[model samples]
Target chain A: MSDSETPQDLKTTPLTSEHEALGARMVPFAGYLMPVQYPSGILTEHTHTRDKAGLFDVSHMGQAWLKGPDHETTCRALEALVPADLISLEPGQQRYTQLLNDEGGIIDDLMVSRSAYPDTEGRLYLVVNASRKAIDFAHLNARLPDSVVVEELPQWALLALQGPRAESALQTIVPGVAELQFMQGAPFEFGGDQIYVTRSGYTGEDGYEIAVRNEMVQDLWRALLAHPDVLPIGLGARDSLRMEAGLSLYGHELDETVSPVEAGLLWSIQKHRRTEGGFPGAERIQREIAEGASRRIAGIKPEGRAPARDGTVIMAGGKEVGVITSGGFGPSAGGPVALGFVPPELAKPGQALELMVRGKPQPAQVIKLPFVAKSFKR
Target chain B: MSDVKYSKEHEWISVDGDIATIGITKHAAEQLGDLVFVELPAIGKTVAPGDETAVVESVKAASEVYAPLSGEVVEVNSVLEGEPGKVNEAPEGDGWFLKLKLSELSELDGLMDAAAYKAFVDEEG
Candidate 1:
């Protein structure tokens, strides 16, 4: 395949020109040409998001909707495929869920939201990772009932405004956004087009995601960048910020072999779903809930300046225990941070371990889930 | 005397008699964005050509800095241990990785000079 030989086939987002104008270093990510970093670099961009507002072009992610006759029709059809209790998700509210395979492994993690407006009663919004879009769409089509229609919205672009000042900055453009708490979504009017927005994000900060049509997205991007507190951030800073927050990326903390219970994401499954046991892999999930998983993911903090990269082996008393999944230098945390799988005994906050980096054992300890405090407004 | 020479691995060597100051070329520094950590070889540590002598880490990943010539490490840039951003700012001057006491001066014969190094970088790009 020419996928590796030629990057010319990589897709471009609505903000590609804007990123190029800002002197961003473009890299191919998930079959799309993306900005990895800008002129100011990842370090500054990371700290700025914590102190102020940072705008990110997330249009590369997949946006789609499940349409059925009513809320119950669509929710029940979705409930059969995923673990989360989507039926109880109130109007204008959003919940994080994972699509599971028959073995209970996470196929993809996505956000499910319902619009409060009566005009769009049958539609359920979903935003999934860019790399897994095709696979996820195929899975949805193959599994869902014929009554529910899967509609992929490629004409819309997504943008995330993240940080402490996110509220005030976004309130200036769409005044209704100020009232949204965490996990709440609604439709707002801008540039004669209705934009879908949610007060949620992956960066573990107070943020808002705006979904707008392609035509007005550039205008909206320019308007958001015009804010004094807002600066455009690239994927490099996004990764570091998420690392400090201890959030799991799809390929790292989640994959085909990683179950929801082992991935430490059982909290996303509500009590009703646990009791109902109607979804795929319900037997394994319910059993794991009753009996703990053999191994679980935990937060790892390397005890030195040198950051341990991924695939580094975890050792305990000269025995290999686990492997580091995702790791990097966290600019905002002012040190190195990582996440990995460990036994239940070693998953505690103060348990000590060693990471064999470059064949040399480096001391590390299991800390709390999030290296930094979550600053969500909710 | 153009005492400067460069390696295909993107390291620059400035010769002062038998001692040489070594660092990654500007092209290499630009490619590795915003270094966050640096681990240099200890003083007096001997290394052959192409040996791993240092480690430079960026925010998202880690990379190795290899020795370009056979030598013993006589001095290192200790300032990098505290602040690694200096390497991206001045990769050849203040950000120099180490100074080596040359053990095999003939190893320099296969290296490239200023003009040749420029052409090599362009062709590689």
Candidate 2:
């Protein structure tokens, strides 16, 4: 499809009717028809997952493969655009990294896994955010060496089983999956189809991401929900989950204007690449690492229940310091939390701050990233 | 049930003498997704027809709940302060948002009946 014609403008997921029947408030998200919330509010869904398990249909995300002669060549080709050192990733290991623009700003965050299974032909597997998939694909195509080939795995549908009980409940369908450690990907047969199962998820919990073929997605979704502990969650809960976990959303925490260093994502950049300085915008990135950027990303905890939505101004000492990137009522915390860029001096863990919501200034406190403690199996 | 009328905004009012018990229709609450908080008008406040009176915030968006008819606010649902999702749980029953003393009963004539309201919802579907 052309870049101008969004898939959301033409496509609906197989679970569209299922969401509608459950009284989900449908919204257009990343070029797909998605449920932002269901009959149970976001707070309820978020809290439920923290205590139980919530199923999310994230099939809109792009799944693709890079198959070629050697792993070194493929990893080197990818490193040209991203700041991560893909060559050091061990077999079955996955790394979370961002694609960068010429200016060293982030294009999108993606998960890249090195396949160890002898049966698999592909050397590297990639999954990127749905909203940035088109541009990312184009960027990869333009930069990859001729020796490497890129193929879009459109046959797959991705589902996330998240929360504390996710592993225990999912084990009912895919036995022996609970043993898979975090940030590891493996192939498993379920519901009569071979699906890619990853021990990682967006929520701050121990969960799995299952990638099933498009034709069998609905069947697999039904099979997982039949476990009695799973509930079909919507985008609303997904947002709150990631926020509490302190994970960055593409448009909110990352954009073409901000580099990875300023966004506090230095861990994703490989140490070798940091010194080698070959990736796009590496020079600027290295400079920012040595001399701190003017603005740095930080978390905000509002005193009241009222949500300080995006674009809310962050103030310190009666002066405008920054703008809120993502803000909402965190169900788990039972109060509003926000992520925004502020001056480096005030970005500490417990600095006092204020947010202007609806012309009223509400007191807040600056905290470190990940407002909600992540329970991911490291 | 003294001739309760509904509006496209999902509000319903049943006249009892000169007073009207106002609440949202079940369909409106369902369409609004999950109700997280409700900002209601103070009792004894007078409001004109079509004036914005209350704010209903779902997890996804915050929407204003306009007054369906001109009236003097007599009572607000204090229970909502503790549990706002009551609007989603029982939109027309215990979830009633407010009660008003009507300034003009004739205003009820301008609204739709239950049958028309159902048809409106069906069309939206």
Candidate 3:
């Protein structure tokens, strides 16, 4: 939350020159000079991805490895720090979880995966938020047992190919990625390098997130752009797509003050992790699972074309209840869409909400998530 | 008809007798990019210069369109309700947001002329 920094000095991603050549508007985000939009603008890029394919530069997110002697040792070791059923993770499987504080506040949410390669049995792969990566790494290292090792990989560039035609376009370059199911990952050869490819993404679309060597990533990016269905998307469209799809953003939906339950992320915690209780904040988490969280996240659709942005106050029965964490005009949703925390009692579908826009109350309703239906290849 | 004048807030005003037409400047539209929503003040609502008279929203963000001179709203381009893209297409012409019956005609002198506004945009950018 407050730990996130808007750094004065910005770092450039490996694909910075490519983005510049494409006439991208670069902005400082998470300490990186990243493209916020391209010449085509956010609306076109957002709708294009839904109609075809879009490539996103996500190399700013941290990639690392959690290593131990074997599967049980590594999985259980990680299980101690986070609430997830890592012990039962089959090879090539990936799970999304949050690193929680002792008080049940989410320090950071991340992706943890077990490699399918026969030689890499004890190692787990991790992809974390760009802004919280350093903090996550520090929190992880200071507590992890001496037996487990963390190897941060700053030399890798991650590219996400997302949308309905993502599979067709990706198969042309990286052939075996089509075989991977949702949340499954495997190492594949691209440009003579073994890149780890996962069938997962933030957009809630059927897509692949590839981790390629920083040296070879530009080539892969160029090759992907060459596809007829593919166009380079910027962070602007990326956020809109993910928001309309009802996915969470790091600083917006989560922070040290937020709990996974309050963020509506209870599904990420498996039954074993919920009941057995050994991780940090296990007591609080289990108690929330048994009792109830006072507030929870819900999809909010403002009635008219007007958009409600982050920090917009939410009202229920003429009394303030919560505030919108993320909001904007959703190109795909055909109007304004938002996500905000509200009392669990009032977080039901069709529940009416009053959003204070420009200091005036505007009508809204709690709709089910994914303002647009997600096309994930389940 | 008076010449089109620009405000520091990036809104433009052009007076024709008692009625003045208002819209966001081209530079402002370029900065906003792909407006998805346009909320105009009601036709009889009175506004003062520098007042937040309308709301404009792009796909990623939202911004306020301020009143350039004191007036009562006489008309608005309802076409924007169905086609907000027109603002991006021709921000200074067909994309005009509203027409106001002027209450203070001399207020137009305070805004910048085209050349000055262009220089101001350049300096700010």
Candidate 4:
């Protein structure tokens, strides 16, 4: 399709012009003008970030605040949808959770932060995926109590600085960033604009996600890129990185069709939330957690170098057990890796399996998730 | 150097002394987006034109490499096992897939020249 199409009409991030100047292969992602690859390509970008640092423009993701009179009401209203323990979230702490439909299927996986700012009414800041922003917002709005208000912060831009040297790189800009533990959020100022820095990211690295005003995002990008250890990363690298890290991409691993339990994200469900069973689909999720799901997410490593892709059939004992949800060459693992669902009995690590690729059954092994060990700085 | 023939699949082969050195062209690498892993053909495996000989996988997609000529793989680039991005970095140079002992040199006559391959790519685009 031509670039003139609505999705490809390509909403520019503040760094769009900068990306073009750097000769990035621009593509449409989540309604934004995003770099799918740079001159070095996804493989180089993927390996570089795993070994060093990669800067990403994630402005397409939605960031917003929930304003309410008290934390209890706010958390209760939020718990009506997500499985996270929003009520117990401490100041600066972040929780990774999903908004579930009534049927227990995932709508979106997001991060909810308990803001330290006492004056912020909702006391919570949220970051949701770009593709599901509208749906997530609408879902939140309709279910929220009158006392709690969800405000969409569309004027902000999100940037992810990820890799081994991410903390040191950010420490150069915000000196105390290293003190913030993983999944914690703090406010930092850059170029006289309010920037919210969070010590969490998708690349399974020690990094920070900086949220800034849309107008100042370009400057923030330039400032971060000025660091010698950082390189501009694209969605291509981002996908491999997340896949290698075994983090779930919203659409690929968690979606309206899959529940958190089946996606192997049961850890996101709080114990109290489980007992309370107030959130959408809590009944199904809790029962699955207790009784075990019929099928569970797994990591599949194909024997040959040929990578199995999404929709590839997973076979075991001569039967179609499940299907590959996401698969590709993992730059970090140094081979082809995949995420798929299989019968619980076959979900063990290193179980022999086969994937149907190109109509041929390729030998594979059912391995544990995060085919590569995660190196997140907790 | 310019005497080599190209295929619509973006493979190029140069013949010398009944042997052919084959590799993907730069355009193919660019089109593939990224080179993450390459499944090379086994040495001494016989392949006919259009037969699947190798597999090149990017982060987003996987593509099969077809044999451009009937031959047996004499030498596969073992170095690419660890550095597949070399294909994208230099598709026609250090990224050469393999050398084949040609079974029939006449197979080269059906492939396009560089100019023709470029035109074909343009038309496909």
Candidate 5:
């Protein structure tokens, strides 16, 4: 369910009814009937997440597992698709990576975590963007060895509790969660159901993404919301939060035509993978790493009040240089901010540019990303 | 209070002889979610019916508020410059976008009256 697709007959997440009950304004997003904002609105919701805890329903994302005879086999099979050094990813640790095509173009960006569950010891839990789930599943099934099996967990619901107080809030319900560090996942019993939890999230805060069975999700959601610090945040705030955090949205900052290097995601590609490349598009990726990409993702801060929305053209000395991929008012920054691709030379911090917004050139500057400092518990 | 007329684009105009006040309907403001910024037409600018007279931007999108009738802009709600959320808080009062000196009073005849506008809004839903 890409944003461009018609929303008719859209799929609903388990929290859909709850969102409506909270007076959320529902909108079609990523092919799902999702809430874009609640009665508190985007600005308040965004600030709430940064100040306290904001719970988000991210079940619309694709969740699945790749199982093999052992961790090595599973990791090796998965390594064939992504450029990330999954072979060295310790058990219970999560790594972010992109699925690339033969040309080094990103098919989708996903989170790959080695399962810590005893029962699923040889499996890797994977989460991909909702819009590309079907294609990702098919791609994995066709490319992975016959010994490995891909299982889509459509019956599970995913929730994120994120903020500066997220850890303490989650600790109230599951005390064992406090033991986990960032990027670590483990299974814990919550209300008699064993749910998987990761101490990491997309919001650039110290948070957790809990995956629970569909039947148990409602109870968990209610219990989590019962906390004084927890509030239900919608997708509108989610985008603003991630944008302020300077994270990339798959379809916006990345696509089948964009590579990780160009998208400024080279950090996820480990040193071993960079030298001994074996994944899809390894040749092109290696070359780009050596010669540098033509265009690089850069942060944009527009001057004044009116925001420069997505697809707004970037102008340098009266010439078109790039286009904004994602842009909006940064509630925390209290001003308009954006991200887009530009020439590597122009991608430097403090580079001045003009954003053609609503047919008018608005002055902007290229700045270092993560507009707000990350609060991860490193 | 003057007689209020509404355009199909969701703008409202309350005529007082040659001067008229313009704003968006409460329903339109609610539909737009939370407004973050507003850009009003400059005073003394000439506008025709259906002209894009103002821009109301919400967190989710930017929308153009069309002129309900042909007129010359005489005043604007400068208060909105600092607090755009006023449009969401009170769309028909302090949130009024601009005031215009009427150039074509007959354009109001093409717009819907209160009862007709109510029916139109209900039909839209």
Candidate 6:
């Protein structure tokens, strides 16, 4: 929802009191009173994350588990909804996938990790966008067989520690976290509490996303901040980070109207799934895969200081060709960067286009994705 | 400094003779947080009191700065184009957004002084 909306009845995360204590500028985001930035401001917070480590209280994201008698059954049930090859996902490994509608449109994009914990065998841990959590849960429950149950784990809070030094900062308190490679997760003990730690993040940096019980998250947050390199970042910097990393935000880059292929997420779909054509909208998606989609998401670099924000029209030869999905000033990139959907022919890196920003036709050019190179430790 | 007045919208105007210097209040800058860009009114443009004469944008959002009184814009700050953070650094002094030649001195009577503006902000809060 809009940030300007009244937050009278907005939900607060477990760290809400802590955020207020830290003098965070609280705003209405996805029905939650979330921090947009702290007193240090967005610029410093953003640069610090790129240089050091920034801790993000992402408790607003939806965490859950899907349970069945065995991994095979659970995976098959999930494969029916998504085009990812969940059956082959090795234990402790995570795969990024999307919940697809019948029309091949995206319901929501999510991270699915096969639980490596012995006690949680035959289960899949999922993290979905907060705004679409309810819709995603209902969609999963309605589609999965009676043998599979969807469990919404509302008792957990997700925290992300991101940057080049995130591992070192976290390894100080939670030893052996460095052993976990990118996209790998495992159970860990912190302060006598069992927490799920995943070596993954959206910032395109070497980081970890820790999921802890709500009761113990505050302690974990405090312990992480105790490190000199760790700073508490808000949603403002988080948006810029992900945007620079070329990650797709739910409503901005993806929606019910956009397909995964058009969003440039074809790599997420498995070749076997693509060939089998069993998932929803497989016919259309396969067709689009074989024949390129009309419009594809591409990176845009505006020529001037002003940003070409969301919904700004893209023009080629004075004719409207596309619209910007996500656009802003990237702190690390030190300029205005944007992501938008344009005709496949015009998606080339060197192709020139004009952005109609504030009624002015500003010169822009298509650029390679991930304006900043990814630094994820493989 | 005693000649400065504030608008309910959080704009500040300082009058010396017929020229008025205008900028946003510190409270406004703090609320906006981290100015990334500032679009100043064009020099030589005429503006009436309450007209949107400038725009201040932060990473989060953009807010319009309304004119405090009827005036003809005399000078616009171009330094903000290279470093908008000046608005957040020294909004009252070096961050002054524009200078205007007052067309109607009576418009100042409708504005609030520093004390009245502080009270107004507290009441709104």
Best by TM-score: 6
The true-versus-predicted C-alpha distance at residue A169 of model 3, in Å, is 0.4
TM-score against truth, every candidate = 0.97, 0.91, 0.96, 0.90, 0.97, 0.98
Superposed on all Cα atoms, the candidates' RMSDs to the truth, in angstroms, are 1.8, 3.1, 2.2, 3.1, 1.6, 1.3
What are the per-residue Cα lDDT tens digits for candidate 3 across A90-119? Answer: 999999999989888899999999988779
**True lDDT of residue A334, candidate 3:** 90
Q: Which residue pairs show collisions in model 2?
A: A8-A31, A246-A370
lDDT of 2 by residue, A81-194 (tens): 889988888888888999899899998899999986666544889999999999999988888888887899988889999988998998888887888899998888887778
Clashes of each: 0, 2, 0, 2, 0, 0
lDDT of each: 0.90, 0.85, 0.91, 0.87, 0.91, 0.92
Runs of candidate 4 exceeding 4 Å displacement: A1-8, B16-21, B40-53, B66-86, B98-111, B116-125
Per-residue CA lDDT of model 6 for A290-363, tens digit only, reads 99999999999998877788999999998999999999888888878899999999999999999997688999
On DockQ, the leading prediction is: 1
Q: By the DockQ metric, which is better: model 1 or model 6?
A: 1
Q: Candidate 1 lDDT, tens digit per residue, A127-214?
A: 9999999999999999998999899999999999999999999999998899988999988988878898899987889999999998
Lowest summed-lDDT stretch of 10 residues in model 1 chain A? A1-10
The CAPRI classification for model 2 reads as acceptable
Model 4 interface CAPRI class: medium
Model 4 Cα shift for residue A247 (angstroms): 0.8
**Candidate 1, residue A149: how far the Cα is off, in Å:** 0.9
Docking class of 1: high
- Chain B alone: TM-score in each candidate? 0.96, 0.95, 0.96, 0.95, 0.97, 0.96
What would the DockQ be for model 6?
A: 0.69
Q: For all candidates in order, state the fraction of native interface contacts they contain.
A: 0.95, 0.32, 0.91, 0.91, 0.45, 0.50
Q: Where does candidate 6 stray beyond 4 Å?
A: A1-5
Q: Model 3, which residues run further than 4 Å from truth?
A: A1-8
Model 5: residues >4 Å from true position, as ranges? Answer: A1-8
Which scores greater on lDDT, model 1 or model 3?
3
Q: What is the CA-based DockQ of model 1?
A: 0.88
